[model samples]
Target: MFDIEYLILIFRDEFNYFMMKKVVKLLPLQHRNKDCVAIQFDFNDSIKAAVMKVGAKWSKTHTCFYILNETKLKQRLFLSLKKLNCFVDYSAMPKVDQVKKSVNKEASLPKSHAHALQVFEDYLIGQRKSPSTVHTYRNFLNLFLNYYAKRDLASIDLRSIEIFLEQVMAKRGYSVSSHRQCISALKHFSELNLGMKYDPANLYMPRKDKKLPVVLSSTEIVLILRSTKNLKHRAILGLLYSSGLRIGELLKLKLGDVDLERNTIYVKQSKGRKDRNCSLGQRIRPMLLNYAQTYQPKVFLFEGEEEGKPYNATSIRQFLKRSCQAAGIQKHVTPHTLRHSYATHLLENGVDVRYIQELLGHSRPETTMIYTHVTERKIDEITNPLDSAIQKFNRMDNETPNPLLSRNENK
Candidate 1:
């Protein structure tokens, strides 16, 4: 009997330890008046560290870590934790589809408003606007319609538009770019649907902010690339910086677009719907060759898990964030920041701005000229006036004796 009891105790302890290692609970909770998903697990230092790495915040009141209850974030959290062999139990939370339904119900427009938006979308399509542009314009028009749901679309005048813009700016805190897009969408919609003439004077367009692009130093770029352990991820970062490809352009790249022998990447239908050839770095060539052999992508250069499908932009961003963290870079880095760094570095290397403009597929030289402001080339070449003055003063002081010191010695 003593032997049997001892065996039972050992079994129970092992089971508890296994459960602690395997199970992670996710429950819906209201955190700071916002719906959040709380991550609850038994005390495990490794698990806690992993959750924190995934950007979950420890809530003191709730006594658990929580993240904003977003679908993408929830999926990311599940995948990230699952990689650690943890079984994420989110059974306590509502299904994603159910949540989306509730949100759609709350924001659904009336039939008349919906019809008007459909017409505006059709008009945008007829005008040959890009799918993304059409989607943005339609969404903005939908917002405008909902704001004036009871009023007729024909009744909206300049004052009404101005009022709506003011309310949106105050409530949603739209950025300068978003505000400008909103104005453009409204102007186009009114001209096409409401038979209003395009008059810039009547509509208020916010001035574009002249904020300089964030640039990573060459050393930081090297560190980011080196810190990325995955070959595919490193290749993505390499292509972005070496070839100066936009995230969208990079995604659209086919296998044939890359010329290893010529050391050029053909960017097709880039910004402004223009195709251009960009220089490829000799250093990245061998990595690409290795990645190609390993991945064996058929259609796109960098295919996702599913064959022929492009790798996700969000995945690139997520892994890039991890790489930056691993590299100990604190700057707010994004995929676009790599592009900016590419342009600035090239300018620093004495590349012509016009050539950069062509490579970047910028329709105007002025757009590419922005990098000139951020490049340190000219600034590094010019010495500071203060330094010059200090050097001159030091030379004079060393060359001549102090009169005050001589007088004091005589006294």
Candidate 2:
């Protein structure tokens, strides 16, 4: 039947007679049309059978078969054509064999949770928060909704909320920031959106644990720097350490931002949309110039494979992990560790804590003071208090002759 179908089509179009035995080209339609995959093919009997099996419909407007741009249909079509050995071009369609799980920090939720999240998102946006903040808020809301899926939203009492938070802390091991976000999401969503009162006295956010930022020792930092032979990687590590720029700030850096002449890197629109000049050491400037000569990054200082695309955060993390292994210093080193070490090392070198705060772009001096606990200044390396006190006591004893007339007797 397919042979007859092909022969009739061949007779109608003379060009079909000279066409290839089997070929399939997937083309994406533009100009405000994205509902179909325009699959153009010249087919043999087996290929025709496969197409018919997948219910490919010929569209006169498109001049090709319109396979609904859908996952199941695409999967079935690909599977049926697998045996034919026909050239299948999937350049137009992203592989949908597995639904790529969204990189949400929260657990995956069902569709019902999305409806609740939409309202929460609208409320956040209405508050004029940044888009990234709103997205993070929405994910936190999703986790809350997932946790209380069985309960009526309005009927959720304070006790249940407490239990849920405990589960997040104990079972999920969510960080303090995550826990805070969750509390904020629930409070706003319930009080503002659902018209339910969220009594903070009943369910209070946990106090943040007094944990020190993990910092690499100065020697370990040098080892990691020396181990990373790639010029781009070294510059990235060095710039991060020298300037104390956040990972996001580092990735967003433009070539024009690095001012080696003034020995400053202009950090633009950092965390709070605030700009500041971070000091770049004379040491890393030569390396930066060499890297510029080699890589020739057009726009962003740290570019990915394609031009103008910022190098991904994952790449930086991977580079740090690999560098740590090679340097034989493993303390769960992340890219942020480099920034932490930079701040702490600066503090250790007698740079004022206030100046370190400014360099780190920290909003609060208290936040910067956390590094002081970890840094061992020259003052800290002085003689022990016990030894100093003992020496002073012995010198006094040597000077004194008797309790009644000690001063003159010693002279």
- Regions of candidate 2 where Cα sits further than 4 Å from its true position: 1-113, 378-411
lDDT of 1 at 7: 95
lDDT of 1 by residue, 1-411 (tens): 569889999999988877755689999886543578899988888788788766687777789999888877888888888888887888998887767764453257767777767788898999988888998877677777878888866666778888889897545666788788888888777766453334545887889999999999999999999999999999999999998889999999999999989999998877767889999999999999999999999999999889999998867887898899999999989999999999999899999999998888889899999998889997788899988887777678688855532245655
Q: Could you tell me which residue pairs clash in candidate 2?
A: none
C-alpha TM-scores of all predictions? 0.79, 0.67
How far out, in Å, is residue 277 in model 2? 0.8
Tally clashes: model 2: 0
- Estimate candidate 1's alpha-carbon lDDT, on a 0 to 1 scale: 0.84
Model 1, runs deviating above 4 Å: 1-107, 193-200, 398-411
Query: Which candidate should be chosen as best, given lDDT against the real structure?
Result: 1
Q: lDDT for each of the candidates?
A: 0.84, 0.76
